[model samples]
Target: MVASGDVGVAFAMVCGAGAASSLGASCVFAVKVASPRVLAIALGFAAGVMIYVVFAEILSQNAIDSFQDAGYSGNAAYRLATACFFGGMLATAALEALAPAEVVAVLQSDPHTRDLLRMSIVTGLAIALHNVPEGLATFVGALEDSEVGASIAVAIAIHNIPEGICVAMPIYYATGSKWKAFFWGSLTGLAEPLGGLLGYLVLSKEEPLSFGIVFSLVAGMMVFVSFKELLPSAFRFDAIDRVVSTSVIVGMAVMAASLLLFTL
Candidate 1:
């Protein structure tokens, strides 16, 4: 007999395959060179995607649902979700603090040099692991509501642009080839659909416990990305850093206020 979650899994796989194909094709198109300042701006764009998802989608969704189910007062769920958001942030901060500095440093470097190829491969592995939950989120969203899924698709696509940039930047800097940079950067995006497939397979059933756990895990994963990946990269440039930081706060505040408005 087919497992309960098989359909979801199948959906995820299909989505993953499609996303991978699309990203692969997109990467082949090379763009002209830009300075470090431009690259930093690209990183900031990535920052916008990450921050927007966390506050606008992830935390906002969690707070509303958890607030009602937990039987918290109007203010309590808002407080709880806000706390959870920060908790997610703190958890990622801890992971960043504990993670091997050398590894991230290598990833932050240019991708072209032959010496760093092995390191780049390792970075790919790390990113692949990271991409799984994002895939799942997109898959589940798509499955649940087409509109929700569409929103998520846009968010994911935007989030991915910087990811491509991230992957390409190092390699392009090292090799100075737009083709090579775009190719590698675009390849990283394939992981999203793969992640979506995995998530759908695992979380298709309507078990509260499973839902809660997946939600928590998703929250954790986003936190890790936001702090470990996005924020640090944002800090690499002074102007971008300020803009990204302001964006983060604005993102969080907007979500928080929205939740407050809804609860009342």
Candidate 2:
């Protein structure tokens, strides 16, 4: 269990990690104005990051490792992980059902603008959902071992920068308001600390099985958002001919490098 004093330190680290998302959001100021192509590319880039991280880190590594920690191995772990992934997708679908297609009002007359806002919303929600379990894990880790927890938090913070951009860029481009985009991105980042608080109250580092399932579910959410929301909207953009595929690739590469660097 986490010590009382360590609780404060763990919470602080988790908050710092979450805040990195807002740091990523702040990057939006770099582009004061955006065009159709830029928006499409930004959406594609976000999707790419989520998809790559889901497959490479969340599912392939974290989920399986979690199952292994629970004493399951090989095919058993994979099967359960797959099941959890779909379950997460169903959860996202349920959340989607709560909102109509035109949930957010778009003042822009451009047809693609509606989809852009939708994509941003989907991305933000997915990122926020994913961050929760991560925060919990980090908090628990810090409770058990400060160095391990700190390392995880720092890696997550770096990972979150792109996630913040994933939420911020499309919103910035779609809404033409930096503050709105930053607000949404910052909002998603807050979920990390929320998770940390949840850990402090209830969860601990032990439930490998549960944590594994959660990791898979989060991966599923990313996959669902990427294919179901982000990519479709990106293709629908009028200036889609250029940048979509390239941006996606670049995002994937960056995510891969980020993961690799952490491993090394």
Candidate 3:
């Protein structure tokens, strides 16, 4: 059974995750326009942070912790972690394959007002689906260790900001209504909390949750997202190659420094 304190922490962390998307959406009203180059760079940065976290932190931690918990060491734990990681990749790949094709089409289409509303709705749904695993990852991290949870939350929030912009900008351009755009963007974020709730319900029932598998799975999903979604989107603008590359490097540095600070 989950303690009351753990429940509260999960709730708070999910709320924070939801708010990050809203905060990004609010930029629609605050700034008249955002440059594509800037957005692409930001997307690259988010991808970099996620990739580094998955390899340097999440997978390594899972291997170590799982071995300790299982009273095993060396190759056995490493193999288990590796298997779980690929399993996660496979699961996310399946989800991606099953995702609504309309959402992908809408995101790729030129920004026409006639289709913008439909696009916003479809995009929101797609984002909601993506956020579910992210929410679960954040909750699991926090449940295992508060500091780790906080770090994951921050990384996911940073990732969500670009998503918020993607959702809000087209809506605002199409309707000239800031509130509508923000509403849809925030609506997408609400899925995070719902996902957290689902995770809590499922995990609370387990006598001893298999955190190693969970962590590996989450890491794989994140890496898949970074590669399949973020990096491709970032590279869509060919002119900003230098900017995106620099941003990615900076993002990795920042996340690495944050991990170091946490350790210290």
TM-score, every prediction: 0.60, 0.60, 0.83
Residue pairs clashing, model 1 = 12-197, 16-193, 110-170, 111-170, 111-171, 135-195, 135-196, 136-195, 136-196
Candidate 3 lowest-lDDT run of ten: 202-211
Report the number of clashing residue pairs per model.
9, 0, 0
TM-score: which candidate is best?
Answer: 3
lDDT of each: 0.54, 0.71, 0.74
Deviation of model 3 at 29, angstroms: 2.6
- For 1-264, candidate 3 gives per-residue lDDT tens digits of 457797789778877977788877887778554566877777788778878877888888754566557665667778788888888788877777766655434546667758778777777778778788778777777776676677677767766776777688677777888998888877788878886787677567543326667777877887887888777767874354967788778888887897898676
Those runs of model 3 whose alpha carbons end farther than 4 Å from true positions after fitting are 1-7, 27-31, 71-73, 100-114, 173-176, 205-209, 237-240, 262-264
| Candidate 3 RMSD to the real structure | 3.0
TM-score of 1: 0.60
lDDT of 1 by residue, 181-261 (tens): 666666666777677766665665555434444554555566566566656655664454646556556545543464456
Candidate 2 ranges with C-alpha deviation above 4 Å:
1-33, 103-105, 108-205, 236-239, 262-264
Sort every candidate by TM-score, greatest first: 3, 1, 2
